[model samples]
Target chain A: MEFDKGLIGGSTVLLILSLLEETDRYGYEIIRELESRSDRAFQLKEGTLYPILHKLENDGYVESYKAKGERGRDRKYYKITRNGKRQLAKEKEQWEKFSMSVNKVIGGELYATD
Target chain B: MPLTKVDKFLEDVLSHIKFPFVKDDISFELESHILEKIDYYMEQGYDSEKAEELSIRDMGDAKEIGILLNKQHNPFLGWLLKITNGMMIFFIILNIYFAGIPFISSLFSKNPINTIPKEDIVYKIDINDDKIKKIQITLNNGETFTETEFYEDLFLFAWEVDNEEQGRYFNNIKGYDSNNNVIFQDEY
Candidate 1:
């Protein structure tokens, strides 16, 4: 079943940024990476993928450059920036807290810390 | 077909995008994705044709994808472009408003100047009581009536209305009482 897009949409940025932090990757490479890692759960559209890349580039979160690929052809690759790492860390911390709260609520141990 | 799957996909995405400069990047990236997917499917022992078909099918709906892409690409740039378009439209209207009226008004109200000199004029006025204020008059064949300077007793004006030639000239005009009111007007 398709994951609720609303739930997944916000995480896409975090995921892309975190992955790029691992290594510089091309568009298709990132798609393959995300898919394989998520076990085909997050099927991303290429059309949906590009604007995010462009936005990250625009925001200085990531940058793209052309380099010769293994096929001896030029391919565009995106690398995460210092700012992206900072943002990714912030998002991860927020997600951990959010997920912990969600897990507690689901496990019937919903408790609030004052 | 020029309507090849890749071509159609690019058309769908680019149509929603407002920025032209970014089109090349989008085209190259998306085209590369489809090509990569085709390569992957072919690696799994599929024929080239089937690989291409699967790759295209895997891309999902172009319109929906375009909408999502637009949602990301257009926030700042779209609002910026819209404001630019709005300002351009506003300035065009403003230019027409400020510049157009006088030009159009001039076209219709293009009256030939009155060649009559100041010296060769005589207006006889018969009045003794009220002072003359400003006189509004239209010369014979003039397009519009306008105010002329005539402080009575110091200056004089005569309105000559011609029936055959279509009407009025203020050559010799006159008269005012103490309070700049019309004292006498004798039209000849």
Candidate 2:
């Protein structure tokens, strides 16, 4: 199936904010979460992940603070803000409405006589 | 081969990005992330060359991502930066007005200053008061002078005599008694 870059790019922010809402995550961990949650179907590149994370940070939807992990490498971890949580709720509602509408149109074909 | 591929990918991505205020450490972390992704791809049975290309291709547009990252991290910090830059420029101009112009002008001042003149010259005297009395003079190689009453202040009397230039030579001046009292006398 072909992927719509714009749609994917647009949804990426909401998807990230949704994930971050559950808990704070570092860059690598967030990428790992997306892949593992999607069952390896959604493979995010580092470039894609960092930029989205950066944008979310710039938009005031997320914040980052540094912590030194076991490897002694300082990791920048991201957390969702109140605004980000609110944005996620709105996006979730829209997605549900959209999917329900699409399902009605698409799923109805399964029941209809061919 | 993997390292070379990562290097090539880094070069390609770095060329397109303009991280105006981003620190080097952040850039390094980004590189590490890319390298890790490359390693993951390689582990998944992709060859080094293919893995490198695939990783970069999956990364999407660097510029777009960089812009988003900037927004997420700072949130309108660009505007803050612009305002600060304007303030910095204004301060530089203000500094020139306050210090630079005065410093340069003082360098070429018309009244040049030197330290030696202050210490080398001396002698300041003040004459508060002087009085003169009636005077008589006889001219000779040495002058004879007489005064009816002596003045308490002598500097003023000398000044008056000098101004008149009447005595051929000023010397041997004496005070005289006007009635019964000799007020003063001087020889000069």
Candidate 3:
């Protein structure tokens, strides 16, 4: 199922930070990883990703550098910073609380026991 | 060469960006993404044109993307940086012109005192007669000193000279009797 743009937009930074936390990834690699991991459910607009990435860089949440990609082409790779890791943890906690509240309101059984 | 569909798409997107420095990187990254997507589609047996079309479509609206990127690359910040860089270069050149030239020239030139030729001697003073009624001192550089009653008996003469060029002055002194006959002459 395709996710709503508004919903994806709100958590875009969180998703990117989580991805970078695993390892450094370039623009295309990040997009491909997000699509494959979500089983094609999260189809991010290719053009919009850069602005967010650049914003994250500007905010000191991530740092970028140029390196050779698998195709021998120089690519701009982004690495998560310590600040981004802290932000991710905070966002993850918020997400858990938010999803739990959402699930409770929807009468979902996943977090019903808690 | 005619612009390709990909190049046209890039131009459309980049045109909205106000910051020129980041445009090349943005263009390179976006083009690489599109090319990678096209490769993915071609692997699935799609023609090159069809793959390119799909890749461009997946990038979403070019104008919208450009506007978003422009927001991140704030033109004010770019201009500020450009102006600051230009000011820095201007200051460096000004400093070289004002400070560096004299220092470099000094290294190659002779000692400042030696640079003044002997012919440019300014002041030559000579005092031999203790009983003098009149005296006149003249310098080659168009400076003259005259004293009628400089002192009661000592004939004291005092004058200030530039210390940096002191070596060029006080070369000789000639004393004359009341009859204007040379009585004493000495070279310093």
Candidate 4:
């Protein structure tokens, strides 16, 4: 299926904020988490992920610093900011409301009453 | 084959990206991720070439991705970016030129030269109907006046006087031309 660029771009930041809610993660770790958690349904490409990460950093939604990895390679680690957490909560509420309405339409859960 | 294919794919992708950003740490990270994807494909029994092709295909359009990356970090894109930054520098230089027009305009106006520091220079103006026939000017120091006159719709005249106490010469001038220009100066 072709991906909608606009939807993917906007949602990528929200997805980042949501993932950082669980714990601090590096770039690869976050991508891996999204893949596993979505049951391999959302296959995010590498090129897509880094740009969103950079944008979030530029927007002050996240911050990064260099840290030594398990294999001794220096890796950039990102952590959510207070602002990021607040934004995540707001986005989560909106997503829930949106998905609920969408499910009603697509999931056949909504019916007309006589 | 996966490595070879991956290398070619990266070259294509990186070429779409302008210099500097393509070689940044972020670029390295993305490159490693693509290699990892190639490795995963290879694990699934695909040859190196197939694995690399699959990985590149999964990555989608690199040009589109590069544009997104540029938009994120470049800060200067779009028309507003060019106008504020590129044209802003041009506009600042233009402002200096625009600022001089009024100063030049004031030199020709009928108003007395209010900008000059008054020391010991005295200025006089005589008007008859629409024509200015003469202008009298005096300096406190022992010096004389020099005059220049030109004809226009009205006669234009100007003179300069030297002051002793101020130890500087002052230009006390007047014009009768509709279009004003400083036609007279006296150093004596």
Candidate No. with top DockQ: 3
Per prediction, the TM-score for chain B is 0.38, 0.32, 0.53, 0.36
lDDT of 1 by residue, A14-90 (tens): 99998999999998888888898998888876557777887788789998899988877678999999998988999
What count of clashes does model 2 give?
10
For candidate 4, what is the DockQ?
0.30
What is the full ranking by DockQ, best candidate first? 3, 2, 1, 4
Encode model 4's per-residue lDDT on A1-114: one tens digit a residue.
Answer: 445657665567778898997788887778788778767656767667877887788778899887867756566788999989888888878776776776777755553110
Model 3 per-residue lDDT tens digits across residues B155-180: 43445565555332444455666777
| Greater-lDDT candidate between 3 and 4 | 3
Listed per model, the TM-scores of chain A against the true chain A are 0.89, 0.84, 0.93, 0.83
TM-score (C-alpha) between model 4 and the true structure = 0.52
Q: Candidate 3 residues A1-114, lDDT tens each?
A: 998889899888889999999999998889999999999988988888998999999889999999987779888899999999999999988887777888889987677456
Which sequence of candidate numbers ranks them by TM-score, best first?
Answer: 3, 1, 2, 4
Top candidate (lDDT): 3
What are the per-residue Cα lDDT tens digits for candidate 1 across B57-152?
Answer: 887777876666666667587679778999999999998889988788767454322233545443433344334444433344553333344342
Regions of candidate 4 where Cα sits further than 4 Å from its true position = A1-10, A68-74, A103-114, B1-4, B18-22, B45-47, B75-188
Error of 3 at A113 (Å): 8.3
Error of model 1, residue B110, in angstroms: 61
Candidate 4 docking class: acceptable
